[model samples]
Target: MNYRLKLIVSFALLISLAFGIGGTLLISSSYYSLLGEEESAIINEYETLQNNLMMINHFSSASSAQNMQELIDQMVERNMAHWQALSIKSSGETILESGDQSLILNYVNSTKEGTYSYVHINEGSSRRLLLYSKMSTKNDVLDLRASFDLSTSYKQWKSQLRMFWAIYVMVVILGVAVAILFANILTKRLQSLTNATKEIAGGNLSMRTGLRTDDEFEQLSRDFDIMADQLQENIQQLKEDVQRKENFMGAVAHELKTPLTSIIGYADLMRQGGLDEGDRLTAANYIYSEGQRLEKLSHKILDLLLMEKDTFTLRKISMRSFMEQILTTTYPLARKKNVNLVVSSDDVYIFIEPDLAKSLLYNLIDNAIKATPEGGNVKVIARGIKGGCEFDISDTGCGMENKELAKITEAFYRVDKSRSRAQGGAGLGLTLCKRIVDLHNGNMVFTSKPGSGSRVVVQLFGNMSQEVDYEK
Candidate 1:
């Protein structure tokens, strides 16, 4: 069933049931009240007749039936016309009477001694109340009866019943109306949510319910929107990751294919025979160089893959001692290239895996040396800063523009591809450096321009205690 109709029907039935019971009770109560009022009036009449008869017994000396009848007529005449009939019966005979004989007989027969009784009679077009009482008068006992016209009270009860039924129906109608209004509002909100979900299912991922109702439904809508946003973001991230992997695979294939082709071609030429010593030497050299390049590329690729699985144990190392060791290690290459190497530092320390940290520093320094020309300078500086240490490796090498700098850390990405290949670079150096720094929860920043020297700053977050403080 439609929810709105269900709500309306439920509400109407409930109201109708409640009002039906109440109306029935009300009609019964009104009927009983009319009966009670009629009874009270009859009792008052009986009391008056009893008192008047007692007075007549004390003062009047007539003593004959005629005198008694005359006295009863006067008494009856003095009373108001609240009843339709009055009667007095003695010795199985009615001495004086008015109104229906049958109704009075029934009332008297059914009446108990020393008590009053009443009966309702419907005589054609009118209803009547017959009241009977037995009383002792002077020397004889008499049955007195009266009939009250009840058509007015009956009409009143009918009117009251009609009014109650009307009210009950109105109450049910109003309840149904309110229920439909409430149901429509509720169903409208639910429909909005349903529509939004359908839109999302149809691939409109950005769809949302902008419901602002201050209720649970509104909160639910907000939560749904948040879930959709997160879902969209996660999907986009997954797509980018897949694209990156595809690009990485393609680059790896191309890099490997070049060296393998050169090595295979030259080796095939050497094996073809009849080559001179000079030609054989040149071919052999070319094959060896390409083989070395392929070897280096394989090791770098292995390092990249292993970095994903490797866990590191970190220890604190003094920045001054670490820098001195770095300088000692790279001095040979610096001297070979005739590039001046320098170091300056303040007391600082970093917490990192020694091997990974060494690799990171070595890669940066080697790249700096390769980029710097003969007679140019390369400076390594370490400094203590609040909560951490920083290292800057600046070189008077050919710097990269912004476009190249942005992708400098991507695998197999190089600004000067020819120069990088000639220097035996598979372009994984900065990528590895970045990974190591990330493993240590550090950051790297590069400042470079096309003509100016590039400065690579590495920030490691850790203790930066001074040497004197460390000793203490």
Candidate 2:
């Protein structure tokens, strides 16, 4: 069943159980209390009659047994007027009897002495109480029984019970009404949350349960909203990742297919064996050049794929020594381009994977060198920072626009595509550098404008260690 019905029914059952048990006990206690009161009154009357009989017997002026018997009979007759519905029996023979004596026989042979008992009698439409007492006299045993009509009290008790039942029914109705109201309120709130969940399931991630009750349900609603928010964020991130991968794959395919197509065309022409020696040599050269381009593209793609799965082992390395090593390797390219190369650093050590760090530096330095004009300057500076180390590569190159700088790290995204391609650039260097810096728990920041020189700063967050891995 739905929550509304379940809540209503459950509340009703609980109230019913509480009232059912309580009402039964209340009525039963009232009944016994009334019966006890009647019984007490009757017992008092029996005791009073016994006291009067004793007094009459003690003061009698009779010396003979026959005379005493005559005196007792007179006393009983005089007192009979005071006792309504009363009966007196001596030794199984009735001395005096009046009104509704039917229940007297039941107590006649009882062995109990000097005690009273109460019995209920049913006569037509009325109920009666019989109080029987046994008393001992000098000459005989007397059984005194008092009959009382309980019809009046019984009618009062029944009437009270009827009123109580009416009240109980009213209370139950009120309880049921309250239960339904509470259940509907609770269920409606829960239903709103459920509907929000359904909407989210139907791909409307913006759906939210804006419940604002100051209770636990409200907290639960808040928690549900947070969960939905996280779910939406995660799903969005997943979509972006998928889209990025698709774009990357499409770019790689295009890059690879272009070179392969050129190579294939040139090779086919050479294979046809129709061109002269010089033309055939030219075709061979074209095929070789395209093959080299394809090879370089494939290597870069492999590097990116491996970097995705690559693990790092960070160790201590001297900042100055590391820069010197990179500068030695990069000096040839700078000299070939007739660009000035400079390196400056403070003597410091940092934790880094040597190979990945070298690759990161190489990509940045190489890109800086390639971007600079023939007579421009490229500077590499390394230093100890608060947490770890920082490297700044500044180049007097043709700087990039803000928009181009934002997308420069994206694979195959070049500021000057034609110039980059002419300079043998596949546009994967910055992308690889960015990935490495991320893996090292660091960040890269670029500062440049269309005309001004560009400065790329690399920040690595790591602990400084005096010890260095000489082998690495």
Candidate 3:
């Protein structure tokens, strides 16, 4: 059965069992107690009647059975108003009798002389307590019988039993009702939780059992809500991961197709054998340049992949020396592009994986040099901060809009697509740079206006750092 019904039935059965047992015991005890009192009262009356008869025999000058019988008759006559029935017998012959003779006869002869006995009798609609005893007189021994009316006590007992059962039934029904209400209140909370679970299973992750009873149910609901939040967050993360992978694959195909198509067309021209030496040389140069672009693309893609799969160790390195190393490598590129490369830094030792850190700084400085116009300045600055260091790279080049800054670190996301392609940029440099920054437990922020220059800030925390030792 359902829980509510089960609770009601259980409560009702328990109440009925308890009340039936207790009430029956109480009524039965009360009836028997009243019956006992009646029995005692009748026995006392019989003793009193017997004593009066013996006293009469003692006082009178009587020696015959007839005189004894006359004394017994006098006693019976005096006490008949208090007794239901009375009988006096001598030698099995009835001498005096009052009240129901049949009832008296039934009990009078059954008891032996010199022995006393009392019993309860149910005769038709009446009840009685009968006492039979033998009284000795001077002339003879008399057999005496007396009875008490118990019809009223028996009738009251039956009435009480009926009334008790009636009240017992009502109280049990009331208890069952209360049990149903209590069960409903408890199960309602369970129902709410069940519904929420079903909704979440059906893909509605936002559902919640907003119970506020301040009991275990409330605590359970709070925990359930927290679990739902975590589940939704994990599912969202999975979806974003899938989308990024799809975009990455599509960008790789497009980048490879452009270089491969051009190389195939120029090689086909060389194969046809119809061009002069000058034209053939030009086509070969175009092929070589495109091949170099493809090589750069492959290296950038490998760096991005390795950044995700590999772990690195960090060592203390001088920031000034590190910046100078990066300047030396990119100085040729800056000069080739006719752009000024400037570096300024506080001498500080910071912890980093040297190769990965160099790759990160090189990509940023290279991008700055490429973006700057001829004779325009590309500035690099480094400083020591508490627990770490920061690098700021700014370029007076063709800066992009504020909206473009957010996607600049995304793979293959270039602000000026045609300009980027013309400069042989596969657009993965900032993407690789972002990944490297994340590996070092750092953050990168970019700010640029359309006409003004763009500034990129890199902050590395969770790294050991100290001011450079000039003495050393």
Q: Write the per-residue lDDT of candidate 1 for residues 65-165, one digit (tens) a residue.
A: 56656666676687644667777777777777766666565544555556777677887757887777776665666777777777877778878888888
Candidate 1, overall lDDT? 0.80
Off-target runs (Cα >4 Å) in candidate 3 are: 1-154, 172-189, 212-218, 311-324, 345-351, 463-472
Question: Which structure is stronger by lDDT: 2 or 3?
Answer: 3
Query: What's the number of clashes in each of the models?
Result: 0, 0, 0
Which is superior by TM-score, 2 or 3?
2
C-alpha lDDT score of every prediction, in listed order: 0.80, 0.80, 0.83
Q: CA lDDT of 214 in candidate 3? A: 92
Better of 1 and 3 by lDDT: 3
Q: Model 3, 1-472: lDDT tens per residue?
A: 8776777788778878898899899999999999788667767767776776667666777444466556556655776446767777777787777677776666544556556787878978688877788867667777878777889888999899889989988988887888788778978888898899999999998898889999998999999989989998999999999999999999999999998999999999999999999999999998998899899999999998987897776677888888888888989999999988889988888777778878888989988888888889999999988877899999998888878888999999988888888888999999999998888789999988776788899988645343333321
| Sliding window of 10 residues with minimal summed lDDT for model 1 | 463-472
Backbone clashes, candidate 3: 0
- lDDT by residue (tens digit), candidate 2, 430-457: 8989988887789999999766679999
Leading candidate by lDDT: 3
In candidate 2, how many Å is residue 355 off? 0.9
